[model samples]
Target chain A: MMRGKYVIAGIGHTAFGSLPGRSTISLNVEAVRNALADAGVEKDIVDAVLVKYPTSHFESIYGQKVAEALGLTPRINCVVDQAGASNIGMIGYAAMAIEHGQCEVALVSFADNPKTGSRAVFSRSRDPNAVFGWFGVPAGYAMVARRHMGEYGTTHAQLGAVAVACRRHGAQNLRAQLKKALTIEEYLEQPMMVAPFRRDDCCLVSDGGAAVVVMSRERARQLKVRAPVPILGFGQGHTAWDVAQRPDMTTTMAKASAATAFKMAGLLPKDIDVAQIYDCFTITALMTLEDYGFCKKGEGGHFVEGGGIEFGGRLPMNTAGGLLSETGMPGLQLVLEGVRQMRGEAVLQVPHARTSIVSNQGGVMHTHATLILGQP
Target chain B: MTDDEKAAALRPPADPLGDQFWQSLKEGRLTFQRCKHCGNAWLPVRSECPRCLEADWAWENASGAARLISWVVYHRAFHEAFADRVPYTVAVVELTEGPRMTSNIIGAGDPEALKIDQALRLVIEPDFGLFVPRFTPV
Candidate 1:
């Protein structure tokens, strides 16, 4: 098993919405500043930096780009890319670096300004091979949702239930871009972006950033940062990048990753107090619940309809608004929200929340990454 | 772009790597992947031969035969481009060779009609475009 004694000293998040004036670099700096302040650690103490950038569309060289912006360029810095899992995976790298005594303090940050250029679901074209020429990201996810409904007798209302719950949670979060409460009725009436996925079922594009600071447990005590959350476990898996190459759309490789993470953390789905499932699409969250073992196979829609994720329900989720309602700069905000619940700062905070789980699927439904955080 | 123009544009431009793969589809030939060095049979085409990393390879015609391994029916289109084709069947077909290739299984869209280990033959869709190497029950 992997060994690490690293702890998250502080986590910070910017408002989850469009900030047209904020450059990607500026967003990174803002998040880093807040994280450092929260950590109560002097900037000079930060030994190294890890930055995640999905494409050159956001930043040219992630390490140098974020370093120059944060004035930490001279310090040891490197970039990490596992596609959309970069943010969550960087947490693992940052924690490892501190555990190895390679760095006393490691700052991890990621942000995107989707508005700078039009980056939407439909705008993206297929790869050159053209085997997947018929569909894009949304189509790939749509296929899975459709199959789930056909196999399990899941209804559109069940899908709407997931969206409605997230919207209810988002309404309480001032930082959420789509804070207005959404009704299941309104969700059903919303225009369809792709069949089985209404406008509200999909995440909003946003311009924002998120950051977290990792250090040794000893350093965390000295810093006296509020309720330090230990990184309990992290797991990652990938099957294929293209939709055409995937064998089964109904199941995700995430199931295996989630199982591995549970085994490492010595925790089960029922042990989680809060779940920040990536809500790129409402169906994504539903399928992830099943894949993560939160519910029986093909029972995620039923589980969601049972109100298991609402504020007062069995599990508090996306307490700060999910990617569906919050700013959708990839899924860094989901990680930020996990830390929020762990720190008891969530608007819909679970009572005595001490443990939380965060998930992210990058490059369609092909890549899966998860992280478990607990207040020790 | 017009549908024809879009289809033409969608077609991969001639390249040293994958042009031949696309070229064979246009000729309605089900190509079999062969190792550049050992001349062993391969299913899915790769940039280099697994046996020898040799970039040089030739495209040969196959019997266009395969068997269905698994399938999923998509009742909703996820993108505007696919909205018209709301429901479709996507499957992984095990070719006679070792490799398995993913493609749409057409003819009867119902899940029961699409059985596992069912024999299928590749059918070329010329007008609908994209040289879809779809499968029909043999």
Candidate 2:
């Protein structure tokens, strides 16, 4: 079994937010270099390189491009695209590749310059729906939020609580992009970009990159790496349907993903010490909490209220600000935070956190991946 | 130019696979694919049945009956073409035949009044030179 056999030996990232002159490739290479340094290893140790394709646009042989820039001729090199879920999904793939003897140490990285490069890519009209005036990713989540509200009386204030918690954590993190602490009243006061979702409910537009070094525990010990966080479990689930066609908008594939991860780890949700949930939208976080089995389905609104998910609360979540407050570079940052929490080196460390779980979802909850990390 | 003329100029790029569905809209009918083998139905014009994966499917005309599953009011238009149309309602409407499609809920005096599962009637109207299907409260 791959469980507990693989570990994230190192994590690294570039300065988030606007980097006007830097290209996505440079950001990716820099992040990889830092990750290798953090692991106390040279570039030669990494034989496999998997990268998430840049989200703003597409490029053929993108993973090879990143690998070529890094000057690595890895045994296995390719791009993984599961939207936001690609980061955690790459870790899982790397583990399988190691087990199959395809590669030993793998480097997984993602870089995007959506903020300064092409914010318009996200705003492009969707097929068939654009004529109906339906546009943007937030609208899809807003529709889900509205349905959740109708079905279970989820309130805007409850969503505000999620934003408040992430921003509160972000305020404590100097590295975070939007670190201004937000109150519920302030969140509610923000202009509604989409009905049921205020500006505060949305994640930042960031131009940044993140990378992680995944290697076997045996390899880490051989290299004498410090503080290698063990990968207890990893799983992925995808709905593969448009939001309108989903069987139920309130529930997501996270349910299946979490179940698989928990089963593989042989640990329940209650055993988790900290969680770094993908918070592309406040509603996404709220819904994910429910699907991950932290709270009963339809009760997520009540679960996150009153500092419930804050650092000192019952379950500290998104300890590094998450996509909501951290650099909105997608899911890899959360995995980085999970590793730090497991290593007890987090800036906003959850005291005595032994086990940390992270989630990455993409495409309006169409794809989901769960990673359970723990102190080795 | 008038607003209607300007709106009509923004047509969707042609797709051969969806020609029949679009043509049906121009003919004042809404059509969805129904699997002839497994009795499944779906929207947005697919070649095969999503459920049974059967190539045997036929276009079934909708009866203009549907229900609002969920909706969002865009306070800011993502597309520059829709910048002037901010504060518009986009919705997921489930047709009686079991296919759900993304559409707009028109004729609602106030979008805030919209509720899940509200009864709606199909309204085929001119959009970007095509009679696209939309919905309004019955």
Candidate of highest lDDT: 2
Look at candidate 1 and tell me the lDDT of residue A34.
Answer: 89
Q: TM-score of the candidate numbered 2?
A: 0.98
lDDT of 2 by residue, B62-136 (tens): 999999999989898776667787799999999998999999999998998888999999999987767889999
| Candidate 1: CAPRI quality band | acceptable
What DockQ does each candidate score versus the true complex, computed on alpha carbons? Answer: 0.25, 0.77
Off by over 4 Å in 1: A1-4, A54-59, A120-122, A129-135, A150-153, B2-4, B34-44, B49-122, B127-138
Cα displacement (angstroms), candidate 1, residue A248, comes to 3.6
lDDT of candidate 2 over A1-376, digit per residue (tens):
7789999999989999899988899999999999999999999989999999989989999999999999999999999999999999999999999999999999999999998899876665667666787777788889999999999999999999999999999989989998889999887788888998888888999999999999999999999998788999999999889899997989888999999999989899999999999999999999999999999999999999999999999999998899999888889999999998988888998999989999999998899999999896
lDDT of 2 at A4: 94
lDDT of model 2 at position A345: 83
